[model samples]
Target: MSQTPIRRLAAREPEFLSTLDALLAFEAEADGRIDAAVTEILQAVRTTGDAAVVEYTRRFDGLDVQSMVALELPRSELLLALDSLRPEQREALTIAADRVRVYHERQKGESWEFTEADGTRLGQKVTPLDRVGLYVPGGRASYPSSVLMNAIPAKVAGVGELIMVVPTPRGEKNPLVLAAAAITGVDRVFTIGGAQAVAALAYGTQTIPQVDKIVGPGNAYVAEAKRRVFGTVGIDMVAGPSEVLIISDGSGHADWVAMDLFAQAEHDELAQSILLCTDAGFIDAVHDAIDRLLPTMPRRDTIARSLANRGALIHVDSLEQACALANRIAPEHLELALEDAEDWIAHIRHAGAIFVGHWAVEALGDYCAGPNHVLPTMRSARFSSPLGTYDFQKRTSIVHISQAGAQHLGKVASILAHGEGLQAHARSAEMRLKV
Candidate 1:
């Protein structure tokens, strides 16, 4: 038989923790050229507006367009694209968009207020972002799901306008993405991408309006542009590679577990898939399944490379040990493939999304499971959360001081201000105490 496609680790080994940490390390040093180019592009877009955006579109995307008007897709074009989809594709897009909209509708928060005994009133005003820009990687890479995921939530949150910018390299547009925009209520569509697209959205051009936030994924250049323009506009998290960690308890079929691992591995060479099981015999069965099935996969080469580089089939002492290690990894997708999967969910503290039971696969969550597939990666699940309606909304604290309320709160503010050596603040609060 050929060599196994994955690495192996034991919970009892002396160097297990260190070895695992080594495998988890994914920090690639920033490229100086890419950063420099992004800086220049941002500056150019900021200074020259529509002219720079048009020039970059022609140079990078190879689209021969004289004006920005040619780049913008009117509402009628979007409608025509939607009409052009096959019946099956249209039905599927409609269902996915509806499910996403229904899910995010539950996440919409309401403005709330409270009154104290002293007649003081205070509250919070929950307001949706005025406008948002979505960036989708175009040209042969069609991600209609991204349009559904990002745009549905923004629409559900009552965002005023949603602009979509997709790069159609050499004038090749993905009709599915445009159809998705049609279904998700995108107000505008621009055939522009990369750092320049981000720059145009962050700082408005003549035709492209500035947005309150930017969402969706793109290549390295686009990621860097979003990173630099963060202070000027809000952005979804800069995500890393997709990931999945499956913990088995010898109950599920070995082939099922193997395919789940392969599902994540197939995303890209950098995507990670690891299986943690307690039974030694079950581990052997999974290994045999991997050997038998690896050859049949269309993306066999990518799967093999990813498994060799980062994937693992670990043997742990107990289910408890698996849970602890999973918490340490903080994976983007965590699958509990066991008989009592629900029982162990409480033990998991950190994960971008949890797939409970054997049937609730991660792939379902990617498409129709109704949760946002845009999750934090690179162990960032420990600190961040999935994108949702809350991401497109902002909260402002409301404070209205009454005469009796000021009399009570002013002294406390005065005391704190004086202690901090800010006499102006102290006097400002002190002046209200006369009431």
Candidate 2:
């Protein structure tokens, strides 16, 4: 038989952990040239503002435009795009948007306060950001789903303004993308992309308002620009490639398992997809299914390369071991295609999203599952969480100490302040004390 593209590993092997580590390693070192370019573009935007933005947009997007006005798309354009969509396409988008909105609504935080015995009120005030920027990848790639996922949460959180930036390479506009903007209630639309678009959003140009935070995905240049401008403006995250790890117990069809892996693989050559199975025969079956099904994929070459590079079919002794190993990997998307999937969720310590049971495919979570598909990648699930309404809001501590409360707290604060050797702090607290 011909060799399968993915590598096989036995968990019982002495070198298993080391092999797994090697497979997961990804380091896209920053190129000096790209860094220099991003830095130059950011500075130009910072200093020159609108003029720099126009020049960069002209050079990069191949758009024959002179001023910011040419680059800005009015609300009417977005509405026209939405109205132009075919019935089926429009229906699908509306359904998906509705689902996403409903899900994020549950994540919205509320302000709360409580009174202490001394009448001091301690609380938190949750407020949405005043403005947010959404950067949708344009030109060669455009994802209308990106708009729904990023915008819905911010809108649900009540962000005052939402600005969208998408590049129209060679003056070609994506109607679907504009349609998404129209439906999502984006306040403004700018047809600019790459580092220049990020810069304009980070530091407001003549027309583009400075957003409090920026969210969405883009190319390497966009990623670098977001990283550079993080402190100046909040950013969602510099995400890594897509990933999915499926654990099976031989109950599900091998072909279904194989297709799930391909879904992640087709995302890019660096995307990772792995299958952990207790039955050796099932692992081999999945491998065969992969070999059989790969050729039919439109992105077959990309999938093959991804599988060859990072994909794996791991043979585990038991479901327990598989669960433990999954925790160690901290995958972005995890599928528990085992019996009583919900019962096993407790064993899972980390994953950006979990798909339960054989019917719960990871692809569903990507599109209409209602959860934000913008998840943390590269083992960051161990520390980070999926993007949600919480990410769009900020909390401020609310403390109101009454005279009675101050009298009781002043002594404590004065003592701690003196111990820290700050006389000013001690005096400040003492002055609040009663004579």
lDDT of all predictions, in order shown? 0.93, 0.93
The worst-scoring run of ten residues by lDDT in candidate 2 lies at 1-10
Candidate 1: stretches off by over 4 Å: none
Q: After superposition, how far is residue 415 of candidate 2 from its true place, in Å?
A: 2.2
Model 1: per-residue lDDT, tens digit, 92-127?
989988899899999999999999999899999999
In order, how many clashes per candidate?
0, 0
TM-score of 1: 0.98
Question: What lDDT score is found at residue 383 in candidate 2?
Answer: 95
